[model samples]
Target: MGATINLLVMASMPIAKVLLLAAIGSFLGLDHVNILGEDARHHLNKVVFYVFNPALVTSTLAKTITFESFLTLWFMPVNIFITYLLGSILGWVLIKITKAPRHLKGLIIGACSAGNLGKLPLIIVPAMCREKGSPFGDVDVCQSYGLAYASLSMALGNFYMWLYTYNIIRIFSRDVIDDANHPEVGDESFGNNTEFLLKPTEYSLMTPNNKIPMSSKFQQLLSQFSGKINLKPLFSPSTIGVLVGFMIGLIPPLRKLLIGNDAPLHVIQDSAYMLGDATIPTITLILGANLLLGLKGSQIQFRIVIGIVATRYILLPLLGILIIRGAIRGGILKCDPLFQFILLLQYAVPPAMNISTMTELFGNGQSEYSVILLWTYGLAAVALTLWSTIFLWLVAS
Candidate 1:
């Protein structure tokens, strides 16, 4: 009973911490767009994307990795793929069963499968690892696994978000075209070859009278490259700092040249580590702010929230477990039980952060994505707390 209570408290502590941090950020007027300023948010993201994030990845991966450790990480991606596939199918079925419009299907699936691994787990997992003292003990290993997990989570989430956005855009464009071509609309002569394409940069750009404007060449080029732009790449101070740290960590020759063999390069490493630590906190604060912004008179239907939560928390995890277990039993996957559990936990996480961004880009179901994200994270925090407590108690016993 004592162990159970301790574990319960331990589990609840992290959730409380997250809630407190979010509350503090809220009270500080971070949620108010006018006060925080958009430029600061952009700069924060730029730091995370170009400098701190990639350095965190390379340093972590380089230090913690063995052949076996690298091999074990494959389980995460497999389970993520399985969960995504099953969640997509289940979301589609739900859409059809409810007789909902087809355009909503992409949003539903995207929300269910995106798994906010970066934002939430940054708080949850380290605490759990510290308590359990599992594979995360060696600072190198912890960094490596964290980076690998982040890379996988972000890449998969980004890919799916893009895919769903594309589908939503296609659906919306089809409707617009249908409307324009309708006989009762009385404007069937809107030009035969003209088309409406939604680009990530410009949202929707319309080509009218079946002619591309020569003056808009620069705009068209910008649209083509906007999604590919990784701003603040070469000269960003944070990027340079992290890269220098990563080089020191990974390359023995560089380490010898820079810091020498006497010392362990703790100063540089610690500085980079401190910056790395800031990445997650900054991300969580941004997410909290985004959620608050989204909640302003946003009419998110409760039914949609319920559906998204059910799909994300229940269906995806179930499907992931079954698929992974079946694969293991069939000798298709050679990963150990610990790796399998990690994969399962990854699937169990809530919607990704990028879903809201994608919804805005596609101009379809942004509100639904925002509502689902807030509710899903709130529910996920509760579920994780309860589940971790139970697991810890079982282990202790």
Candidate 2:
């Protein structure tokens, strides 16, 4: 009982910090306060998105990652994918059960599928490791590796969130826009538009009179290939930051030059670190301000909110335990206990804060998503504390 209480206290500290920051944000965003009002939040979000996030990704990954660490943490990507698959299935079910509106269905799925693999774990793991009586030995060593694991998790989470959940929200929300614009046509017009986007130029290998030349056919094939692939998401600022970080971290010469105190160019990395430090607080503040909209009474359904909270907190964590433990039993995951714990923690986090940004970008479900986030994150302190305690006990034992 003493051990459990100790673990619970350790777990709750990071969550408490997050809530405190968000509380300040919420307070500032109030009509009477207005420091973090809608306009202020919008501008701050731009700064965080364009500046802070990329800097954080680049500095953290460059500092923590190396060729060896990459090999050791190979299975993490697979584990994250499994969480997305399971959560997505649950999200789909919730959408159907609630009969969520077209605009909100994507938000629902986005919330379920994209866990907050970035900020929360980055905050929680290192903080827990520093606490008294941490299950992982030697505070310094534990915190160092824990930060690395969390950084890599953030990088990969950004990759998946942008490519997968971003597109889902974009497509669904666009459909809603199309329907509104052309109420009589419905999906047919949208389908045609999508087809047009995918295959803008029709390719012909044959004509009524003669078969097309191989050279022309090659060009046609190239067009089709390029048309189907949307690489815009791949080049997002955060994604580019990840790629740059990987380049610096994986190559010993580059890593040594940029990352270490002895290196001549270490100032670059230090600058990045300074900028990156603002990411968590700025994001948390924006989240709090967004929640103000939810408090103002949005059209979101109670059942949808409850369903997402249950799926994310209850069903996902239990399934994550089974998957992580089963992998250990089967000898597929032979990493250190801290790494295992991070994998488990990934499943147990709140939805990605990026989901709200996506909805805002697409002009759909901004208020609804804010409401969903408010409930999930409001309850997150308890949920994460409970699951973190269980995960700590499981891994430590």
Candidate 3:
């Protein structure tokens, strides 16, 4: 009982710190306060996206990751993919059960599928490592490894979220907007290039030379696939940071040049670290300001809210435990206990705050997405604390 309380306290402190900072941001965003108002938050978010995030990702990953370390942590990407896949399936089920509105369906699915992989873990892991009696081990070593795991997690999480969740919401939201504004003239315009590729077979059959070459058919299929999927988000700044960091860390000569105190060009890494330090606070502040919109409330259904919460907090975590433990039992995952803990933790986090950004970008469901973020993040402190405790105990055992 005493050990359990100790772990719980350790877990809750990081969450408490996050809530406290967010409280300040929320206060600042208030109409009376007017410090981190909408405009301020928007600019700050861009800074984080373009500057702080890349700096943090590059500095942390460069300092810790190497070719060997990268190989050892390979399961993490697979773990993140599993979480997204399972969560997306559950989101689809929820939409069906609730009969969610067209615009909100994508929002709901994106929420379910994308966890706050970067920010929360970045804060929680290092904080947990610093706590006395941490199950992982010595504080310094634990902090170093934990931060690396978290940084890599953040980079990859953003990659998947942007490519998968962003496109999902963009498609659905744009469709809803188009249907509303133009009922009669949908995708019937001549410029709809996707139409020709989609009906290539129909077009080919009509031709006198009825045998379309295999190469032509392959190119047509490729075009159709590319047309449906947006790949631009896959190379986001954070992801590029990860790639750059990997390059520096993996090569022995480059690693010696940039990473250590003795290196001549170490100033660059130090500068990046200094800039990266601002990422957490800046992101949390933006989060608080954005969440303020939730306070205004939306017409979103109560059942939908409950469904998303239950999926994230209850169903997903249970499945995570099973998958991770089964992996260990089957001898598939052989790495640091902290690495496994990070993977399990990935399954338990709340929805990505970026979903709100997407809803705003798509120009619909902004208020609705904000409301969902509010409830989930409001409960995240409790949810994360409990799961962290369980994960620590499981990994320690």
Candidate 4:
């Protein structure tokens, strides 16, 4: 019992820090302040995405992940996929039950499906490792391995969130979304791209049948091939980090150069690590700013919010416990409590904030997404703390 109390405090402190930072972000985003207001927040998001996050991803992966760990944790990608699959099913049910608008169906499903796997765990896991009475033995060992797990989760989450959930939102948003103000629709060659791909080759210019060039055909084939396998996410920085880091950690020469004290180019790795350190705070602040928008006004129903909350916070965690424990019992998962703890944490987080941007990209139900995010995150302060405490107790025992 005493240990549980300590675990709660250990878990809660980092979350409290995140909440505090988020509140500050909200304050900065207020109309009166305008520091992290809409435009500024967008710019900051760009920085985090293209710069800070990638650096963090690469550094963490390179520093902690190894070929053995990668092989052992193979189920992570599958686990992430299950979260999306289950949430999507639940979201679809919600849409049908609530009679939600067709335009908002994808957004609803997306909100249910994608968890904020990156930011919170990055914050939570590291913070938990820092506590006085932590379960994970050896502070440095705990931090390193904990980060490896979190980084993998973040990479997988980012890949899945954009590819699967983003497409779901994009596909459903197309019919009802307004073309006039919809950013992607404004492109002159929007529908023409697909038309060009499928159109038969013209005989000749004189016959007024334009001959499609071989290059064009190949390009279309390439595009179709890429889309079929969802290749875009594979190239995302997080995935790249995983791939490159895996190589470095596995290969002797590269690993020696970037890791440990005596390496010649350790400075470069250190530089990246320093830059990567900025990721958590930046992500939290953006989360706060986005939540501010959600709080101000939303047409979303309370029941919808409750449904997502219930799905993410309660239902998914139960599923994780079963799946993970079963995997362990069946000898598929290692019994490392920290690794187990990280896997459990993956299931219990809020919806990915990137889903909000996705709705905006499709020009559908961005406001509704904001409202959903607000409630989930607001409740996560309590949900994450309690769940983390219970999870630690279970894993440690």
Best by lDDT: 3
Rank by TM-score (best first): 3, 2, 4, 1
- Residue pair clashes in candidate 2: none
lDDT of 4 by residue, 288-353 (tens): 888987866678777888888999999888888899889899999888999889888888999998
Model 1 Cα shift for residue 53 (angstroms): 2.2
Off by over 4 Å in 2: 181-230
TM-score of 1: 0.69
Better of 1 and 2 by TM-score: 2
- Each candidate structure's count of clashing pairs: 5, 0, 0, 0
Model 4 scores what on Cα lDDT?
0.81
| Residue 396 lDDT in candidate 4 | 89
**Candidate 1, residues 1-397: lDDT per residue as tens digits?**
7666667787777677777776555544353434434556556666776766655544444344445555555655556666667767777677666655545666666666566655565566555555543433555545456554554455444444455434444444344455656545432222232233333444334366645565565566565345433332234343343344445545666555434335556465455556666776777666665665555535555676778778877776666667766777798776443344455566677777766655665576676666676677668678767655554443333
Evaluated at residue 19, the lDDT of candidate 2 is: 84
> Whole-model lDDT for model 1 versus the true structure?
0.57
Order of models, best lDDT first: 3, 2, 4, 1
Candidate 1 stretches with Cα past 4 Å from truth are 1-6, 29-43, 132-152, 159-272, 325-338, 389-397
Question: How well is each residue in 1-397 modelled by candidate 3, as lDDT tens digits?
Answer: 9999988998899999999989989999999999998888888888999999999989988998877888898898999999999999999999999988877888989989899998988888988888888888988888877887888999999999989998888777766666668575454322254333346354753346656566766777676556657888889999999999898988889889998899989999999999999998888877887788988999999899999999999999999999999998999998467898899999999999888888878888888878898999999989999999999889888
TM-score of 2: 0.87
Q: What shift in Å separates residue 342 of candidate 1 from its native position after superposition?
A: 2.9
Which residues of candidate 4, in runs, are more than 4 Å off? 177-234
TM-score pick, better of 2 and 3:
3
